[model samples]
Target: MSATFNFTFDDIPNLERKVAIVTGGNSGLGEVIARELARKGCKVYIASRSHSRAEAAIARIREDIGTDENLAFLELDLETMKGAVMAAKFFMKLETRLDILVANAGLGGIKSELTPEGYERNFGVKHLGHFAFVSTLLPLIQQTADGNVDSDVRIVIMSSKSYENSHPIDFDNVRTTYHSWFAFLTLREMLQRYSRSKLANLYFMRELADLVKDRKNIYVNACHPGLVYTHIFDLSTSPLPWYMQLVGQLEAKLLGINVNDGVKTALFLAADRRVVDKNIKGILMYPGPTDGFVYFSNIYIRTINKLGLDDEARKQLWRFSEAALEKA
Candidate 1:
């Protein structure tokens, strides 16, 4: 695909007054995004599951960015819907407005399991947790938009290009039937579940953008961070086929982009003035490595269409998410 717009952290304007939250900010792409925002003078709250990890990330980010005042940690565990709700409440209690909300935390490549909320582990944490968190904080995001005339209030969901592989979500089978099996079969199931959750992220982003379209000042978008080397895969923790492990190592060594490069599209959607100027919303962004341009292409459009994603599907997912949260 051709590059459409060239963007980088250099294009991010001063964010001294902005307040942002990045889920899973303790490591990987989330940490990269948080550090960049902190560097740009934004107050960044690193929300994740572990207190120690989040604290360490905050400390490291503060040291790296040379400012400690705006970096803080808020405990969040997305495996449970209640944890997401509590995180939202905690943020609302502490911050008056939210300038950026990045749903960047996710997990993949694991054995089949169900969360306490009775959803597939991958779908529960990566999609539903963020869904609940965003639903609770959306009012504050809208309020931020209402008060800020000079900047756009943004929500960025970190989806993956693997979303292209997802089948249309089968709500009834979201908690997939489990069977103990060999490493390769388990790995395949894990990836399939992860793909489904990423697809859910896209559906949620599209529906959310539509829901908030009338606000005029709030912008919502999702992005696919091209393959990058990170610790999300732990072969020691979850066994993988020997050949699959070899392939993963080769891909990481040769083809994977650095985490810094992986985060460009998310940073663009969060802080780029063009997003607000062009009123870009509900679109999926893909950042090209060659020119650092973020664009929407026909292939992505065709993929979404082939996946059978429509307004009705989006709305159904929303309802299912809300009902699931209530039950949880």
Candidate 2:
């Protein structure tokens, strides 16, 4: 195995009496995060679109941790704005507080389609869907901080290193559909959909941090897990022929980290005392080499403007997202 990350599961502080929601936690890196948090005695809700899969994940978590307690499923379908809002509303009714939100559910691949609400699938699910979920849940998170003196409410947004490759947000084209032939011809646009969505994650995190600057103990941040060999990569290769898929998987096996190591930075931001102690917020971070654990950087798959969007662009995104949420 490659040199392990400096941070490990052992470093995560005890999360007893805490509550967490790991979106897309039914599998892959999110599942590992859910299990690790549950291991530390935190009540975790594995939020996803698939109830049966969520239940299975909960069952496996219970079996391995040897406890029926501290694990359950919260159905959250990020494919649509309505699903996102409803899930947040359901959680609001079910629980009084939300301590940690790992906005970890994200997807991208060869397909290009629009959600019912008319957004590109990647942009719809990764950015707009989470926008609705977090917007609906923001009050509860704020209340948790206001009410509990010891509460350090953390929102960990999952962005990708691919974000560096994205150009400015294309508001007009966001809802447009590119035919398969056209999309494949200008493949950059297809890839940009996912990358831009990730950049949106960072934009959301930054704006939230500024909004909560006055609020005590609320930490908002975004991170990338490095390139992990997960189902997402498999999905990326789905449209390819079988032999091509095999070749892609083999390539990923060489280039990407495993799911276990992929989760380190996320867990650190979630439960590490140093986050609150050092007051790390609003910063874009990725796993570092050795010296200091968290570093600010991203991987660019294609050459583009290296800089992120300005504040005006982010404000525009927020306004556009809020308007979109209104439709649901």
Each candidate's TM vs. the true structure?
Answer: 0.92, 0.89
RMSD of each: 3.3, 4.6
User: What shift in Å separates residue 250 of candidate 2 from its native position after superposition?
Assistant: 2.6
Extract clashing residue pairs from model 2: none
**Best candidate, lDDT-wise?**
1
Local accuracy of candidate 2 as per-residue lDDT tens digits, 1-328: 1222346788788898889999999988899899999999989999999999898888888888899599989999998999999999999999999999999998766567789988988889999999999989999999999999988999999887778888888898889766444434435666778788998888888788889999869999877787676777665533444565576567667766666777877888888777787787776656655211233232111211344547887888989998899977
The lDDT values for all models are: 0.81, 0.80
lDDT of 1 by residue, 105-175 (tens): 99865656788888878888998999989999998998899887776899999888788877778898787
TM-score of 1: 0.92
User: Model 1: runs farther than 4 Å from truth?
Assistant: 1-3, 180-182, 289-305
Clashes of each: 0, 0
